[model samples]
Target: MENLSLGLMLMAVGMITVFSILLIVIYLSKLLIAIVNKVAPEEVAVKKATATASAPTVIDPNTMAAITGAVNIVTGGKGKVMKVEKI
Candidate 1:
């Protein structure tokens, strides 16, 4: 009876140790990712909404065709994309 109890105790301790190590590794990885994101924040170009509203949009012939085809397929050939513009 004592031997069986000792074996179960050791098994529980081993599992707890493994779980603790996994948690520590996960914490360290998250900390590293946070530090990296802070150091290298993404660059977003913000334009004036009023300026965007008045700009002349131009569509490439190739892109327009591809977009039309994709849209037609996605809409089950029921509709099409009339235009695609590069801003």
Candidate 2:
């Protein structure tokens, strides 16, 4: 009976120690995240609300003709360029 009681006491103590350490780790991690976020905050890119972003760019008539001709030649006049996007 004494041996069984001693075994139970040791198991309880070991489990409590592990549980306490895990709780401490959780709180410390939360604290570290808060400190890091507050110190070096992320930079958000704030773009100006411009009419240019939504508008389509005008291409010179000759340049458009050349691009259209080249694309038609490459695809054997099968694929047509519906819209040209400039980066």
Candidate 3:
């Protein structure tokens, strides 16, 4: 009976010790992150100037016809090419 009680006590102690160490590690890591962030803050990203819209692209008749034909074939004459844009 004494041996069983000692075993239970040892198990409880080990579990408590491990739990305390894990909690300490987690809190310490959080503190370190906070300190580092305060010391060297992240830089704000610069916004890029957007490209202006140019003149409408002109599609040649042959290329337009080919695109139209492909669309018609894929959609069984139900689809229409409304606008074509170059990459």
Candidate 4:
């Protein structure tokens, strides 16, 4: 019927329009992300905070005592830490 053909044509036009718009949006979003990454990129935090690998780490007596005390309490005085390292 003519009415059925007309309805099918309208539906095809609407679906094609929606798909075209969605494709444009996807490409635009990808382009924006690429622009942002090129202009101002995300920096790694680990590179900004680093210590000399050659120097030994030192802890103050008070900090060491507190850490040992906490460990002792947590372990019910059954374990002790031989060494400590800063990560």
Among all candidates shown, the one with the greatest lDDT: 4
- Candidate 2: stretches off by over 4 Å: 43-87
lDDT score at residue 23, model 4, on the 0-100 scale: 100
lDDT for model 2 comes to 0.80
Candidate 1 structure lDDT: 0.77
Q: What is the descending lDDT order? A: 4, 3, 2, 1
CA RMSD of each candidate after superposition: 6.7, 8.8, 9.9, 6.2
lDDT for position 43 in model 2: 41
* Global local distance difference test of model 4: 0.83
Q: Report the Cα lDDT for residue 76, model 4.
A: 100
Comparing 2 with 4 on lDDT, the higher-scoring candidate is 4
The residue pairs found clashing in candidate 4 are none
Per-residue lDDT over 1-87 for candidate 3, one digit per residue giving the tens place of the 0 to 100 score: 999999999999999999999999999999998987788654421211122222356676899999999999999999989999878
Using Cα atoms with residue i matched to residue i, what is each candidate's TM-score against the true structure?
A: 0.43, 0.44, 0.45, 0.45
Of candidates 4 and 2, the better by TM-score:
4
Q: Among these predicted structures, which one has the highest TM-score? A: 4
TM-score of 3: 0.45
Model 4 Cα lDDT, one tens digit per residue, 19-38 = 99999999999999899878
lDDT of 1 by residue, 1-87 (tens): 999999999999999999999999999999988887788654322345435653776555686788888888899999966555555
lDDT of 2 by residue, 50-82 (tens): 335526666667988999999989999998888
C-alpha positional error of residue 43 in candidate 2 after TM-score superposition, expressed in Å: 7.6
